[model samples]
Target: MLSAVYKSLKKIDTYLFIEQRDDFSKVPEPLLAMFGTAELVTVLNLSTKDRLGIADINKVRAELAEKGFYLQIPPPPENLLKEHLAKLKEQGKLSEKYNK
Candidate 1:
């Protein structure tokens, strides 16, 4: 991952706005991804937003620290079929000739 980051950086010929910071050896990959994806260096770098994200993650971590408390992944909503079929009807795609 570090190598890929370096290779991408070498390809770009401009100031990347990398800030000086302490060691981040203990940070998880998911959290690390946020560093690059959150536009912290470009858009808004308000410390409050980062604090909120960390607070949320800390709550999840605390829940997992419980004995035998497995995290549950909720399934996606399933009631959108009727709505999608309605859209298809409006588009005239629900007809047998159009479906073909």
Candidate 2:
């Protein structure tokens, strides 16, 4: 799932990948180890059964499949989701990410 991380990861003061899917049971330990003690990265784990326990893994997966990758630009202050939402809603089907 980390493969779908946004290219511009921002303000990562701390992070925990609240894993809700059964598929992602292993940490990207090998990748992390490469950095070693030189870097400071805060990684934590949380199963789908966290606070609210909202496991929308399927939705996330579908979104990733449609986009050929999972990524989300943080919403703008005015919330432009409607514009994208409209475009997506208008489509009868989803397609893999098209590199425009």
Best by lDDT: 2
Clashes (N, CA, C under 3 Å) per candidate: 0, 0
lDDT of 2 by residue, 1-100 (tens): 3321212233332222322322223435553343232222322232332331232456545554454332233333565765665566568343455312
Which segments of candidate 1 are over 4 A away from where they belong? 1-22, 28-86, 90-93, 97-100
User: Could you tell me every candidate's TM-score relative to the true structure?
Assistant: 0.21, 0.25
Mind giving the per-residue lDDT tens digits that candidate 1 earns over 1-100? 0100111222222111221222234345553453433221232232333332212434333443432111223344587877787789888879776453
Candidate 2 lDDT score at position 100:
22
RMSD of 2: 13.0
Shift in Å, residue 35, candidate 2: 22
Clashing pairs in 2: none
RMSD of each: 11.9, 13.0
